[model samples]
Target: MTDQRQDAIPDAIPGAVPHTRGVRFAVYSAHAKAIDLCLFDGENETRLPLNRTATDLFALHVAGLKPGARYGFRAQGVYDPDRGLWFDPSKLLVDPYARELDRPFRHDARLSTFGVDTASLVPKAIVTEDRPVAPAAPRLPKGGLIYEVAVRPFTLLHPKVPAALRGTVAALAHPAVIAHLKRIGVDAVELLPITAWIDERHLPPLGLSNGWGYNPVAMMALDPRLVPGGMAELAATVATLHENGIGVILDLVFNHSGESDRHGATLSMRGLDNLTYYRHVPGAPGLLVNDTGTGNTLACDHPVVRRLILDTLRHFVRQAGIDGFRFDLGTILGRSPQGFSRESETLRAILSDPLLADRVMIAEPWDIGPGGYQLGQFPPPFLEWNDRARDDIRLYWRGDGWKTGRLAHALAGSSEIFSAHGLGETRSVNFLAAHDGFTLMDLVSYSHKHNEANGEDNRDGHNDNHSWNNGVEGETRDPAIRDSRRRDVQALLGTLFATRGTLMLTAGDEGGRSQQGNNNAYAQDNALTWLDWTTLDDDLVTHTARLARLRRRFDVFSESAFFTGQDGDVLWLNEQGKPMTTADWEQPDRQQLTMLLKTRDREEDRATRLAVVFNRSHDALAVHLPGGPWQDLFTKDHVFSPVLPPRTVIWLRELADPSARDKEAGES
Candidate 1:
């Protein structure tokens, strides 16, 4: 077929756009000699060569081609792999801007082989018509809780969820799911990667599949498996969440694509323009920069890549009304050959863009590259995952020495790290556990990672988890061991909730979901990873709910400002109720401490003081209070005897007394 192009067509906008006459298909490939728009009609294939309308763009307008048409691209160019050129006309390429995929990507050896016709192997990109949803502001509160969720595993075995909607994005809108989120007081749900992804080439050989959708191929296309209804389903789910006072934050992976290393699949970007889409060694174009530990890192500094990322973000915001985004391996976004910078062009663009300015931006601020651990370096308006807090909290609860100061630092919003620029509020997304590591229950039940099922010989996950088994490792029938583990989990949860800054809870962690001690259960898509809602620990769920309510009810728990010891804003006290001196903080075996804070009781609309006592010892400790008329924050019982249970965190609030009320006000 002869090339056809119209000067009126906007070549700058890459992707298939349906218009009055037909569909306008455009793709960007700086190095391709020629590109073909391969249309699929059942078993028949029609190849139409595209005209090089722009310097680096191919464009064509095909009449009668409508929205629901399945198509792929094939580029005919130099086929040198050593010099970073992988143009093979036999390989079918998905559109970089594809909004929908006809099927999920299936990896095969032929996909990476040269001269292999992969029209049947690769998933076809479907031409879709855009239906923009009404724009709305983000719904995440400043210090709200973000519940990290993997779509399929979260609802796959949920007894209340419908069978048909068990593992789909549409199921998130179901009343059962929403009720669970509301019960745990999840202000926002950070859905893990829902984009179309191919299994790691190594997985299918081992009879395993990628349960976590971290490996992405199509950046914009919603996975036909996870999101069956495409953009419409996601948009509707977001609307439903917004109606229930919860927000939706997509956990996006832009650091790398599923194309993997040089031996990886010849997918869309790699075939279209490998040299342009990915970062390569300066002297050796064939050598890719493995910054993300995911084969190849995206050349995010490139103009083409920057535009694609921005366009993708805008599309989600405009079409789905998405509230925010949590960037996985986020350091890659601001990295260049010179290393990472907070003022990178892409970071600036996302911050300056009118449409994205108000959205919540969170960064998983680390990768495997040089200078990748940029914990507190992200600029304002971008909250970062604080691994420091996670490790310190775990170490403290594991009966480590001299961790009291570290725990205090984390609980107070980690001022030393976040306050370097003199910022009053912390930009930390504090959490005890996340999707990448052990669940909350496992943190107190497993001493070491039990990833035997991952086929990697248990060397995949974190080595030093800073975890401890109460008495016995793994699951035990001993009631004492079980009760000890439960108490430790509750204490950890209480510590997380009482900490200052934004909070994040992995889905099912509130109700004690375990991965059989497998910290890296990314490949176990079966019952091992699925959350068994029927057998969830109801008492733990209740404890989590109460913690959530306490966090919301007391303005102190949500305060963004850093606490100062002056004026009773905050005080670290010993078990004797006196200000903790250096000797007390340095006590290696001391596991009991009190955190006193001046706060406002929102329920009573009165200013009151709160004391959070933590005891990690095996024996209950008697603690003295400086103030009178203290009551249990959750139980509402007067603190007749100030004694903390073993491995427990007790919250005590000063009761309102007419006699001492005015004196307390005067002192403040």
Candidate 2:
């Protein structure tokens, strides 16, 4: 890792003119017979003939043009979706890697909604615009809490925030939002996507706008609409987050772009280099392989495509001060021309890169391609969103049978899955809810998805949610049922913080954020998705903050590296403190489990040990505690004897000065 000094300095801010020379552009036009370039010089425009290569990449060498300079590309061709050719020279095409968009696209009078029409409502391009870029912030990974959130709704309707700043990247810096995050005790905010994106032409017809920014257009640049301040505004937010001791972990979608199948949009790499950018249409001349389930998957195997991906990341880290990234459908990044290979150049390059090693790198670890699930396959210094961890944890606490062993491995960091990589507990980015599906609240509120509000007739999101609502399907007025459900939430949070892995939490899950049983709230931008910051139930918010505080108390929970202990740092036991039996592993009504976790590598000061007891049932149950002086992490009630509770979780920690519990609370 480079010194935390001058060498770690980020790239020059975007608004400031980069002293380096000429303009750099990447243009795409799939069916253009000829292409032209235009530069905006106030009202008057300059034109130039782009030099064409065999791959159809048009390049123009120009003087006096640099970053923040406004420019666009014009392609001439027959525009048609049925014939699968869309090229309109009159429409201006924005560079896919534009550092900043000229302006946000309005759905009103002048817009580009053309799939493949010569004359279209939507243009396959954007105009020239520049937003100021701010100075970069220092990236920090130490004990950082990862809060994954969708960009639009997180701040869109936040009552305390200004309307203009809502739904934009610049809003991230807004005092109200940042103050909330700081108060919540998160170290980093994992934004879903901030890149330029396109809502599917088909989705708009359904009266629903896509909320999740999964379909990407530009890779390296910030979406102009995301920031009313543009690139300059986005940069300033990074500085603000850093100043506040929070890091930014972006959820990047390298697996695919907004360009759907061959007959879809033509704004980016698909236009500039089709056969090289996207997987070719199978047995068809101009079709595109839709491995991403969206429309087209990027060709990660191509040498040039690989370079673009790598450069995009480096540019962001060097310039954007991006503390880390969680790659969407990341398994695709490791596939080669022959097939999926862990040794693929893309993986090797990222792992070995000098510039990127120190930054956090997380992966979604799956794709739609054959044999595309590579959950435990990413290299070291990397973390993965452990689906096994998510499912097993949910199953264990939901009172599912024969799950003790499954639960053990999950809480112990799924060593069997990631052990081959010499990874210890921290590599598993454990979570129960993410942006793709159900929120934690709905995880217990509904057994099946209720996505009718998404206008997909409840067919849009995942079905097998592994959620148990304590004997009810939705909200309940019965205090016993409601309290029991809240207890399950408490248990899950306790288990997550007590486990021996670094954690990545979905944004609103801690405070019981729900989509009203709609697991997929990706298309609803209203209150259905926006966090009700105004009325977050006090009990849920208290539990979430307590979980955050508890994680900090344990070294294993907060550290970024794997546990290097000789014996297992985490051990599982039954009520008898014996090994789990076959019967205990399979009984559906039995969801109680116990764990002991060593908090450090034995080299750190203020050593601590944790014992966690859990029960996922409605009836009150007693659980045995290890014979040690234990202070309840949440309540600080000292327990020197066996301790148990009904449908509850109790966290016990070994503190150096247990008697002065009041002193610790005051300092905190």
Q: Pick the candidate with the highest lDDT.
A: 1
- Predictions in order: lDDT: 0.91, 0.68
- Model 1: residues with Cα > 4 Å off, grouped in runs: 1-6, 657-668
Residue lDDT tens for model 2, 1-668: 11123222233111112334554443433345666666666545566766544444555445556655666566666666344455655555555556556554323212234433322332222333334233244354454568887777777778877888888887888888887687667888888888777777667777766677788777766666675565456567787888888888888888888767654555645544456577765555366667679888888877666767777777677666777788898888888646787788888888788777777888888887788888888877678889988998887777656457777777767788887756554578888888878888788878888889877678787889899777889878899887777887887887776655667788777777778788877778678888777757678878878777666656666554444444546666677765557777665566567777666524335545677777666555666644456767667466534546766777776555423643666698
**Residue 588 error, candidate 2, Å:** 6.4
RMSD of each: 1.9, 7.2
lDDT of 1 by residue, 1-668 (tens): 22334466664479999987899999998899899999999968999988876456788889988999999999999999899999999999999999999999998999999999999899999999989988787888867999999999998888888899989999999999999899989999999999999999999999999989999999899998899999999999999999999999999989999999999999899999999999999999999999998899999999999999999999999999999999999999999999999999999999999999999999999999999999988888899999999999999889878559999999999999998666778999999999888889999999999999989988898988999988889999999999999999999999999999999999989989999899988888999889899989999999999999988888986777888788789999998999999988888888798999888889998788888899989898998988667888768566646778899998888876634876786799
Q: Candidate 2: TM-score?
A: 0.85
Candidate 2 ranges beyond 4 A from true positions: 1-33, 40-46, 53-57, 63-69, 76-91, 105-143, 421-426, 559-568, 578-591, 600-608, 640-643, 654-668
